[model samples]
Target: MTHSDTDTLRAIQHTERERFIASHPRSMALARDAQQHYLFGVPLHWMRDWPSPATLFVAQAQGATLTCADGVGYADFCLGDTGAMFGHSPPALAHAIGEQAARGLTCMLPATNAAVVGGLLSKTFGLPMWQMALSASDANRFVLRWARAITARPQLLVFDGCYHGAVDDTLVDMDPLTGGTLPRASVLGQVHNHAAFTRVVPFNDLPALETALKQGDVACLLAEPALTNFGLVPPDTGFWEQARALCREHGALFVCDETHTVSTALGGYARAHRLDPDFMVVGKAVAGGLPCAVYGFTHDMAERMVQAKNAAPEGHSGIGTTLAGNALTLAVLQASLEHLHTAANYAKMLDLASVLEQGLRDRIAASGRPWTVTRLGARMELQFMSHTPRNAQDVRDHAQSELEAFTHLFMLNRGVLLTPFHSMMLVSPATTLNDVAQLLAVFDELLAALRALPARPATAPASRSA
Candidate 1:
């Protein structure tokens, strides 16, 4: 990419943004009306982050498509950013939630379905004990408490560019220049320094990980099977094997956060790869897009946690919320585990994802663009670089924000929705080959527009001053 090419892309994005506002009068009006009551004119502040001129108000969503307030249907590859990864409003989940709604929503007491769900979870995830929370953020937070309690250590080890929900400790990133941990600058309203107890290491770097653990201070190593937040960066071959060994050798608990990587398999990537971890978490889709997150533990880990709990003076464990593990959530989880997360459904999702991956690669090749595509089961991401990124710096160095904005807006105008934060696309079991083909066709148009830009002498990107 050149300066001229970037200017041309920005111009195209401006035109697309205008086209969106002109076409979506209903959504624009709704947004204007909502501004009086809602922050940033939307229920969630992040909704305003989309490249569209205004937030799109979804009238309805089902399967792999959603209708906006303007009555335009879009092939919804975003899938609520993997919260609806299985599919929107799955029939079994809908029925279960409806029935549970009449019975009662949330009671402090356990429901009958809780036992059944426990059995299914143990069978699927290879963990003997489980706990619940309202979101992956809560689950990760609660588990970190348990980790510190059991290991009696003060620090946590996390990879650079990793995202484990909004947990405060995991928000720290490695400062590239000084190689020191720093709280991510994007996080809002932080008053305390998080780097004191959080050790940051780059993904796939075994030596750095070993050196960090050798300090004998980390209580746990919290990680995802693959990096999906900044972009999809898969683990190198045999990476987890050595990483797990190092954690165990250093007496630190190993935890895998599968909130996004749950799309990889019925039991998530940890079970699929036989990577033994003391704790594992699955959220978002676990309760059919409802607010529920489950963290599981191995038998030994469970025993250690029990001992920690027994030793504490009884007040509050600082673990659960009032709405955690409600009857409605358990009912939905039972239905989803039984029907939605089945092997057959996953096969369909994986097949569709393969089609999507190949289609994007073909389009990139045809356009003569130095772009690449990476897939993890049902999830895939398109990076504006020639190869998969190896670490966080690789991701930053290769990112083309202007190009991403233009591509996202282009797809939005053509009744397709990619994830707002990145060029990530997810394929559900309900996604058809025709839908994939349609997305590829629009992608071809985007490429053609990029190729039409006049060539110019390329200038090197300026070096960072700080």
Candidate 2:
């Protein structure tokens, strides 16, 4: 981007910020009050990451719409960053939660629905045995312990720019200079070097992955089918197939984290694509927005886990939480599996996402912007570059953070909400065509605003290999 582009983006961002503050008086007041007690004026520090002038306080959310405290209604394409990918408060899940509240919340024991949920998990995700946790982060952490225990290996492999939700082993980044793993710079309170046990490689790089796995010390290769945390860099054609084969050839377990990629299909990207991971984790939307996640594994892998446990000295495993698989979560999971994670619902989501993807592409073309859209079933990302990125390096090299901030703020000012971390849009089962149209209208308005700026020559498009 040129200096003129930067100036235009700043101008638009200023106007949008002002408009947002004016429209969200209630939210602004609440944010001011919260600042007296809450850190960063928010319950979670990351909640402050939104581009809004103040944190938008939610009054209510149902289906694909969110109403802020100031009575502003937004067509929410963020969907709680995939936590509500099936849509907020789906009737079945809401009902299940209500019923379970009266029965029992948690007793540190299995609920009546536990057996049934296990069967649903096995049938839906194509894995026979399973374990539960309070979040995908916890599940991923447990799976890493199990993989290391069973395989008796010390090292783990992960793709660069991957996020498996707060797991320490997955928090390291690739050192561009030496192609070695280094602790992520943004990570705080780190006392140990994660790179000692974690090897990082670029996504879609088969040779790098094969070389890493050939070291024979890797216990598991944990990855998403498509990287989501760093702006949705998808696997190349035949990437997972070859990666899976290489892991098997080198004795590393393949653990697919489908926390976000569950939006890809009824089961997940792993099931939809038949990647056949040794272990699979599904969270976020898995329990209908409840704080629950589950990890499943093959029968052979389960047997290995049992052997590892039996061979160990009896003690706390450091593998589960008290609230995980609680009665409330189990009931909600059953309802979500029966009602939300269906082929019919997924069909609707995919159709809507297809419409959204094409709509974005068409709008980008009309605006004459060198932007691109990448879609994975119900999820889509509007990137600032012309070509789809092959890896995290591609994204970092060409990222236009200022333009991205302007786009998000612009959309929010127009009663539309996108994922704040990136220009990601998710289509839920409850997302309607009208909601999509509202987003598109705002998007078009945003493009027109950009076009009205002083003319500047377009830069050459980046090469596909870039």
Clashing pairs in 1: none
lDDT of 2 by residue, 1-466 (tens): 6777778778878988999988889999999999999999999888988888999999999999999999999999999999999999999998998999999999999987789999999988889999999999999999999999999999999988888988888888899899899998888898898889999999999999989999899999999999988878888999988999999999999999999999888889999899999999999899888998999999999899999999989999888987888889999999999999999999999999999999999998877788899999999999988889999888887777777778999999889999999999999989999999999999999888888553333343332210
How well is each residue in 190-262 modelled by candidate 1, as lDDT tens digits?
8778889999999999999999999999999999999999788999999999999999899999999999999
* TM-scores vs. true structure, each candidate: 0.97, 0.97
**Which parts of model 1 have CA positions greater than 4 angstroms off?**
453-466
Candidate 1 RMSD computed on C-alpha atoms after optimal superposition onto the true structure: 2.4
Candidate 2 colliding pairs, count: 0
lDDT of 2 at 14: 91
Candidate maximizing lDDT = 2
Question: Where in model 2 is the C-alpha error above 4 Å?
Answer: 452-466
Q: Rate the local accuracy (lDDT) of all candidates.
A: 0.89, 0.90
